[model samples]
Target chain A: MIHVQGLRKEFGPNTVLDGINLDVAPGEVVAVVGPSGTGKSTLLRCLNYLEAPTAGTIEIDGLALTAGQETRKQIYAMRQKSTMIFQNFCLFQNKNVLENITLAMEVVQHIPKERAVDQAREILRQIGLLDKQDSYPSTLSGGQQQRVAIGRAMALHTKVMLFDEPTSALDPCLVGEVLSVIQQISQEHNTTMLIVTHEMQFAHDIANRILFLEGGSIVESGAPDEFFYSPKTERAKQFLQYYSMKRYQ
Target chain B: MNFDLSYAIRQFPTILSYTGMTLRIAIVAMVFSVLFSLIITIVRYYRIPVLTPVVNLYIDLFRGTPLLVQLFFIYYGLAQLFPIFVNLSGYAATVIGMTLNTSSYMTEDMRGALESVPRGQVEAGLSVGMTDLQVMRHVILPQAARVAMPVMGNEFISLVKNSSMAFTLGVREIMAEASLLGTSSSNYFECYLDAFIVYFVLSKIITILQNAVERYLNRRGGAVR
Candidate 1:
């Protein structure tokens, strides 16, 4: 479970998040959808303290941190409760795919090498990249690399997984493979997921609930059926119209 | 200015005798400089409080001056100021001066390579629950070392050539031996030509080694896509 309250982020007097509040239940898939620059990515980053919030409290799986009231150690501990997948697929270039997946498990988690490699192989099998295990990230396509990144995140077994536009960097043909992998993982595992993505259709399909953010605030959030079919806010309606028009055309 | 082939040919055995001294000086200086520069690069990368600026000043001072002057100062000037330095061997002074001079340039080379690693890589490491120190040791340094290899190879090759200057301090290296043999035999051309051949061959060997190392690194993996 994850709880956020009064989350505020500021950059040189430019407020990025304005006292945002949210709650996510276990096994919930919440898709954050909004126009660009609406702080969707920043909000996800704040959950893991990747970008420290100017003011807020984040609680995930019993680990809680309130901005300015937490020590660095507490912050690090809180970060361990969650893992993130980036849009650009930032795999360790120096490591082969198997080594990339096993690195954190062995180094950070202190899992024995044999067990870590076994776990990594299992995750690779799940992602259907077992053959590419020995290949470096540079040799993989953007889609294959992103799957490896997803496999790496899955291996951590964190309470929540935050994804920042995971498919935004992929080619049109490659988007389905990555999204299907994400959908399959969410279905099979009871992990809470908060995904910030522009793929409205994928969100409609995968997310049980959708958050509509505008001007750094959640203007409307509800079950996908209500949020997509009958948005209550004028800003959300206009934004969805623009999104649908741009997405289809 | 007769080119005496026989004398030049005969000078090989004598010049070869001093090759060991030159190799020793260059190897010792290279090892010390690489280790020292690694320290400088790490300190500067972390910006370690007061020490960072001190290291910067050290780099600037050594890099700005000629190595010959630095050697003379360490060997001749410092000995006058401190009695202990009066007994400092010319070999020690040469090694100290070359290490100090070469490490300054190496520090900058390594720092640039370290910085060139993308910010995304560090963030990715942190996102995976690795601490800053772990990220540096596991991810950043390995990539930075790969990036810095060619430049480091060039620095080492230059260091080999630069060690020739140590002759002025009477270290009895190749150049010093060549000059002594040249004056004694009155075959300056032949003796100096032999010295040039030795330097050329040594540099070629270093270049070959550099290429082999580069190939090995590339075989490990390509740069981040």
Candidate 2:
């Protein structure tokens, strides 16, 4: 389980996240849908300590991550339990697909080379990119690179996976392929996932719970069916109307 | 006006001996410089508090100064200040001075490489439970090394050419030997031209070596560009 309460983050004078609260139950897929510059990415990053919160508490799997020396260590430990896939794929330009997957295992987990290679090969196969394992990220298509990024995350075997605008950078046609892979992973693995994305159809289809964010705060969050069919706030209605129009055109 | 092939040919061994001395000093100095520069780079990369600024100032001070002045200071002035230690050999003085000089510039080159690593790569390492040091050591450093090779190779080439300045300290390197020969034979133009040719050839050799290293590292790193 992931829990966040009154989470606040500041960048100098600007408040990127202003007293937000949320929770994700185990094995749940929660999608945070918001317009651009709504601090969606910051909130996701703060969950993993990629960006530290200015105030409030985040507890994951019974480990409390607040602001303190001890909490910092706990936050680090918590990040190991959660894997993040960046929107840009973030594949190392210097490494081939196999090396990219095995790097974290060999260096961080201290897994032996033979064993790590075996595990990496298996993950690559799971992602359906075993043939391209020896190829560099530059040689792969956008969708393929995203699959490699997913493979890298899966290799960590984290309990929670954070997808920060996973398919936002992909071509329109390619987005479906990456989304399908994530949907497949969500079905097969027991890992909890929190995805921040712009694909409204994808959000409606895969998210068991949806949080609509505006101006750095959650306007509404509940089962996707409730939020989609019966939005409570005026802000939620406005957001849905805008998403619908964009989809129509 | 007659070109005497035998005279020039006879002078070849003398030139070759001094060239060897010059090459040895440059190679030794470059090795020392690369080691020290890497140390400074690692310190800066990790943002080690009090020491990082001090190292930065040290690099700036050495890089900003004229090498000729540094050579004189290390060879003559420092020696005068401490007579017992002043007995250090000319070869040692030259190597020490060149190493200090090259390292000041190479430190900057190496720091640029370390910084060029994508933030995503560092973040990925940390996300997987690697400490900051481990990320830098195992992942960042190897990637940086590949990006840093071409620039570092240039520094090495410059170091080799700058090694001629050892002649100013009476080290009897190629340039100094050429000066002596010109004076003795009253063939200043011929002797200096020969010295220039030697330096040019050596510079070309370093360039070739740099290209070879770049190709090898590029292949290993899987750099498409």
Kindly provide the TM-score obtained by chain B of candidate 2 when compared with the true chain B.
0.91
The parts of candidate 1 lying over 4 Å away from their true place are B223-225
DockQ of each: 0.69, 0.58
Measured over all alpha carbons after superposition, the RMSD of each candidate to the real structure, in angstroms, is 1.6, 2.1
> In Å, what is the interface RMSD of model 1?
1.3
Q: Write the per-residue lDDT of candidate 2 for residues B1-225, one digit (tens) a residue.
A: 756556666776777678788889988998898899899888887789999999989888898899989888888889888987578888888888888888888888888888788888888777666777777777788888887888877877787788888888888888898889988988777777778888888889889988998888766656733
lDDT (10s digit) by residue, model 1, range B49-142: 9999999999999989999999999999999999999999999999999999999999999999989898889988988888888999899989
Candidate 1 per-residue C-alpha lDDT over A168-225 given as tens digits, one digit per residue, 9 for 90 to 100: 9999999999999999999999989999999999999999899988889999999998
Q: Pick the candidate with the highest TM-score.
A: 1
Tens-digit lDDT string for candidate 2 (A116-137): 8999999888889999988988
Q: Highest lDDT: give the candidate number.
A: 1
Which residue pairs show collisions in model 2?
Answer: none
Model 2, residue B130: C-alpha shift (Å): 2.0
Candidate 2 chain A TM-score vs. reference chain A: 0.96
What class would a CAPRI assessor give candidate 1's docking? medium
Question: Model 1 TM-score?
Answer: 0.96
